[model samples]
Target chain A: MKISAKEVQNVAELARLELDEALTAKLADQIGSILNYVDTLKKVDTTGVPPTNHALSLSNAFREDVVVPSPGTDKALANAPLKENGCFVVPKIVG
Target chain B: MTLYNLSIHDAAERLRKKEISSRELTLSVLERIAKTDTKVKAYITLNEDQALAQADQADQAISKGIARPLTGIPLSIKDLICTQGLLTTCASKILENFVPTYDATVIEKLKAQGAVILGKVNMDEFAMGSTTEHSGFKITANPWNLDHTPGGSSGGSAASVAADMCLGSLGSDTGGSIRQPASHCSVVGLKPTYGRVSRYGLVAFASSLDQIGPLTKNVKDCALMMNAIAGYDPKDSTSVNECVPDFTATLTQSIKGKKIGIPREYFSTEGIDPDVKNSIDQALDTLKSLGAQCVDISLPHTPYAVAAYYVIAPSEASSNLARFDGVKYGIRDMEQTELVDMYKKSRSRGFGLEVQRRIIIGTYALSSGYYDAYYKKASQVRTLIIRDFKAAFESCDILISPVSPSPASIIGQHSEDPLKMYLSDIFTISANMAGIPGLSVPCGFNQMGLPVGLHLMGRHFDEATLLNVAHCFESATDFHTKRPSL
Candidate 1:
């Protein structure tokens, strides 16, 4: 549970976040304390217990494949920071 | 009394009798908001023109003898719930100006009832923190004491009701978000069972734990709001297909033989304010005098609730928030030279510190080496916590406890310590972890004159019993009648 700065950097990179040395060090301590506290779960016996992702027991919901009208392209793209002819514009990907 | 001070029950009755025009009520509340919002900062966006237009429409409907139950009732919406064409910021800068093209399912329901939406209220960034101080916009103050917080992330909604700015408001509780704020503000707040209310169009937090309910001046208004908002929705898969009951049908029912469970663990927990403990003890006595049996119950896994919730909620948040990556909508970093860099920079800058911290924790928990140890372990522990409730409910009609360990803390009290802030949710999180309905009703006040809340949690989809118990208590005491003078 000892979260190192390197570990914070690794996780931040995976999460697509750029953390400075100061924030990374701070997070290292914060996350370390949190994880250390959660380590108490290790004491519980769960030899054959199934994990519960949701509180209720629900099965896969099915629906017809029929098409329905949605917010048109214009409205859908309204909040985009940058947009092209009709699509969202992002930084260059292929180099 | 000013129209702003009228409870939804009384206001709706007066509206039906033509004793008050919807426009008059709307204008009065608007005027009050204009006067007091500077000190409370409860609202994020106030729709004066739109609200007046809606009120006018409601008046026209009344003239035509077709006014709905919520007709002309002005209510505040937590910014996390989508309102078509209105900015729903979730108090995060990332979605600072973002407006949804469509309404949340609950908004659609309220609109159907001819309800007037006053505006979106502030909350913690992405509903991440307990105090509204984490808002990227501004902090909401406790109406009772300006120096203290109106417990959050639904702080603004609770404050709006307590300050008479709105008759009722909608807030989503992921952990203790709704109930805690309602407790601090001394209003009635309920977090309906997961799946009891649809989550469609609610800005996703922890999907499994998030449930939208009402914060109102009294238990009757809470039930009325529930009657309007609680039901099945085909749009949300998790919404229960079971029949929705009339929540108001049994509010006046007697609790002659009702079994009220007192979890010993909740009372014995460290850091429980002595004032809170005293209030809860008095509340139990009040219930006992009302002919209810208070039985000792144990949720043995209670200590693990906060730990399990932090992991499960943040893990789900990491996946849900991954959608905000400088694309489609929300803020985007335009200066980045590359796509990957843009994603990193946009997220790093767009999200607040607490939000980023959760995302980081979630990411680390779900990462390759740690998934089994953290995420999986947390989910398993969540099962145990749920089982603990299932067993406790077997002997109790409803469980009563303190909504919070203490009243609202000072505005900046826990901002520096993340773990300390997380621990404040002890009393309220288990309900969410178990996905049951929990209600917070004004019980008493601390020495500082800050309101304390009595917590009542019930079986899944059993909000009626919880509301009945709260209504009975409110009838027996004047706690719910005490309002903060702004």
Candidate 2:
């Protein structure tokens, strides 16, 4: 039931958060306590009761694909952190 | 005259009457932001020139006798809603300097209505934290007590309104983001039914549950904002096609014979403050006097809502937040060797600690090895939680509960513990999961002088009933008029 330091590191890796060793230790304790609190659900007996999903009893709500010319490209790139050649510029993927 | 305190309705009326020009009102709000925002830290960015220009245009349109419901009302927006040509960071570093090109559906609607855009308000980074303390920019302090935190993730919007920095503002509510802060600041916030307002432009947190809503000083103002913003949008498939009722029409409906349900589950535990409990009781009694009947109902799965919400919300968030990697519009990583490295480095450098924490929790919950037991199980529980609300609604026309377990906590109080922070949303999350309208208004004050919020929830798209019940209650008391002495 306890999320240990190792498990915390693993979760961090899965989450893509770069936690320092000290922060990892702190988070392990916190996550462990939280998971323990969440464990209260284990005591319930769901039996034949079906689990719910959409609260409004809705289903199959999807919009049709219709392309509309977006606003000006200049307006789009006006606030980019870095832009080049009308596309977002990022650091090279392969070094 | 302070432009910030002018109600949207009043501002619109004044523009129509040529009493005060939109240019004057816009300048007033812009000047107020310049004066008070440094202390309130309510806005992440201010669009003074653009807002003033829009106000001028609005004035010109009105001079020609052109009219719209929200025309000329200068309003601010929460950072999460996308605004074209404006920096729309959700108070997170990931999109810190990113400007969106496309308008969210609400933004388009507001523009069509001629509502002036003042700026974007601060929020908890990626809408993760209960207090605006998690905002990467600066902590949004309560207008009443600057040392304390304002509730989040619409903390800045709520703070801006409370401090008279804006007359009306828009906020996104995934789980109490709109209502909690509205309650803390003693303002009126309306979270319309999930699909009642479009989610096309909101940065998805819990995609199935998130909706944009209005935060205003009073109920009538809320109705006017709702009238302008509510309705179907083809872009958001989930946007309801139901007729956008003239919400203002229902304000005068008699609450007589309405069956108000108070879920015993909400008050059974020690989670609510005593003053809030008393205020709710007082409101209930006032409803009784007004000819409404009070009944007790049970949402037995109430306890499981937070557990299921944290699971499903994070599961959806994990997928939604994946778009923020360096390959997209945000800050990109400098060095990367592989696709995974691209994601890792981009995300690491872009997002803040809290957003990263959630993405991690969500990723773990939905990971292949754990999906069956964690994400799937949580989805199953989400169904049951929805069923709980459905079963409760069948017994009452509207449900009443506390907005938060307690009033606003001091800044930095629970910032360190994510679980404890998540628990703060316990009372408000279910409404989002159910995709229904929930309104939070000031009921009374706790011992510490912080406002206590009473949540009123209606059946799906039944904002009329909710407003009527709330309107009736507001008339019976002066709670809505009470303000914090800054």
Candidate 3:
């Protein structure tokens, strides 16, 4: 359950976050303690128990394939940090 | 009494009788906010001009005899719930200036009933923390004592109602967000059964656990708000297709034969403050005097709730928050040349420390090798927790306990330790895990003069019974009538 700073950095990379050494170390300690506490769940006899992904017993909700009014490009891009030609502009992905 | 001091029901009656105008009520509330908000720090954005305009429209509607229960009544919204063209920050810098293009379903419902929007209120960033201290903006102070926190992440919603800045407020609860703050502020708050209220436009935190409900001055107002917002909506796929009851109808009904379950695990658990325990015992005695039977029951998996919730909520949160990659909306790091670098820098800089910690924990738990040990194990434990509640409810009408382990603590009491802050939600988290309706009603105050809340939880989609029981308790106690001298 002990999460080292290296593992913290690796997880941060996976989560698309960049953490400095100090924050990574701090998080390593904090997450380690939290994981240690939650390790108590290991003691519970959940043998043959199904995992509950949702609290309510719900199935996939289906709706008629009817077209509805969208928020439209103008409204959708209103909060975007950068945009051009009615679309969001992000950093270059192509090499 | 000052106009701002009127409860929602009282204000609605006065508006109906033409004894007061919406403009007058709204102005009075605005004046109260101007006077008290500096001390309480409840509001994140006060919608003054728009609120006045909405009030005038409500007045016109009233003149035409088209006034509804919430007509002309002003209310605050937790910042996470989208308000069209209004700032919804989630108290995070990432969304500091982001305004919604459409209303959340609850906001649409509130607007449909002629409810006036006072403003957006502060909450922990993305509704993450137990204390409003985690807000990217300002810490919301408990109205009872300015130096103390209004237990959060619905701190602003509860504090605003307590301080008379607004008659009622809307708040979303993922864990104990709404009820814990309501308990601290001595107001009424409810977290309706999951899927009872539509989650469309509510900023996702932990999708399965998050639910929107009301924070009000009294039980009846809570019911009134429920009537306004509770129903199925096609916009949210998880919204239940069940009937929404008139929650106020059963308020006057007797609880003479009601069986109130006293969960032995919650009572026997350590860390419950002496004063809170005393208040709950007295509240139970009062219920008993009113002819309800209190039965001792066991939810053996209660101890595992917080642990299981931590894993499941954050795992889901890590996935849900992955949408905030600085592409569609929210802040973006324009300086980063590479797309992946922008995603990393934007997220790390935009999210706060606590948010980052949760994301990392979630990512680690859901990682390839650790998924079975953490997320899967926690989900299985959650199943056990839900089954435990099912067994307990079979022999009891509802469950009662302290909403929080203790009354409102001083502002920095749990700031240093994240685990300590998470433990504050022990009593309230199980209801969210079980997807049951939970109500927090003012029961008594501790020796420190801070308030304690009596928690009542009912079966899935049974908010009516919870409200009725809370109303019955409210009638027999004067706790709801007491106000802070702010």
Candidate 4:
């Protein structure tokens, strides 16, 4: 249950976060203590208990597929940090 | 009473009677904000000119005899809910300048009711922290005492209502965000049933746990706001199709013969401030005197609620926040050449320390080998917690407890320790975990003159019962009427 600095680094990488050594060490220690506290759940026997992902139990909400007016390209890209030619501009994915 | 300090119902009556104009009311509120918001820091963005224009429209509607309950009311909105063409920062640097092209379903509903929006208020960045100190913009102080926190992440909403900057406000609660701040600031806050209000425009936190509700000066005003906002919406699949009742119609109903459950675990929980306990005990006596029966009940899984919430909320947040990568919306890093590098750099630079910590914790919990030990186990515990509430509700009409273990803490008291801050939400988290309606009403003041909130929780979609009980308490007490000296 003790999270090491290296594991913190690995998790940050997986989470796409760039944490410096100090934050990584601090997070490892903090997350380790929190997990240790959360380990109390292990004491509660949850045998045969179905995990609840949501509080309300509802079936799949399906609606008929139909063409709906979109917000339009201009409105959709209004909040885009970088955009060009009615499209979102992003860094090159393929060299 | 000053026009700015009038409750929604009172102001509505005045506006309808032609005793006060909406423009006058809005001007009074704007003047109040201009005077006090510097010290309280409740608002992040003030909509002065727009509010005046809306007030004029409201006055026109009033003159035409078509005014609604909120027709001329000026209210602040928590920054997370999208406001069309308005700055909707979730109090984060990532979306500092993000403006929504469309209103959130709740915002649209409020606008349709002629509610004049004052502006977007500050909150914890991403609604992640219990205190507004984590806001990327600024920290909102508790109106009662400038040195203390207005319990968050709805701190700004509660403080604005308590400080008379606005008549009422809309706040989203993922855990105890709404109720806790309402408690600390001695205002009224209600977190409706998970599906009771549409979440279409709310910036996703923990999607399953997040809900939009109202914070107001009194319980009836809270009910009025609920009547305006709660209902089904085709836009949000999670919004329930249940009938939205007249939330204010049941406010005057007597609590006689109502079965109030006193959770034994909550009373015995460690670290509950003595002053808070004393206030709750006195409040219970008042309820008992009003002909209500207090029953002893057990929610044995109460201790594990904070633990389960940490895992589940963070896990959901990590996944939901993935959309913030440098491309579609929010800030992007232009210095990085590679796509992945830009994502990493932008996210790291955009997010605050607490956000990064949660993302890491969530990623680690959901990681391959740790999934069973963390996320699954937490989900199973959530089931147990839900079962506890279901059984407790069967025996009692409502559950009453302290909103928070203590009153608002001094600012920076828990800033150094994240776990300590998380534990402050212990009492309030279970209501969110169970997805039931929870309310906070001003019960009494602590020894330091800080307000203490009486927590009332009810069955699923049973906000009426909670409102009735809170209204009854307000009728019998003057706590809600005691304004903080700014």
Give the best candidate by DockQ.
3
Give Cα distance to truth, residue B432, candidate 3, Å: 0.9
Q: Give the better candidate number (2 or 3) by TM-score.
A: 3
Query: Which pairs of residues have clashing backbones in candidate 4?
Result: none
Query: Pairing residues by index, what is the TM-score of model 4?
Result: 0.99
Residue-wise lDDT of candidate 2 within B102-158, one digit each (tens)?
A: 889899999998889999999998887778998888898898788888899899999
| Tens digits of lDDT, candidate 4, B29-83 | 9999999999999999988888899999999999999999999899999999999
DockQ value of candidate 4: 0.86
Q: Write down the TM-score of every candidate.
A: 0.99, 0.95, 0.99, 0.99
| TM-score of the second chain, cand. 3 | 0.99
Better of 1 and 2 by lDDT: 1
Q: Candidate 3, clashing residue pairs?
A: none
What is the fnat of candidate 2?
A: 0.46
Candidate 1 deviant stretches above 4 angstroms: none
Per-candidate interface DockQ score? 0.85, 0.47, 0.91, 0.86
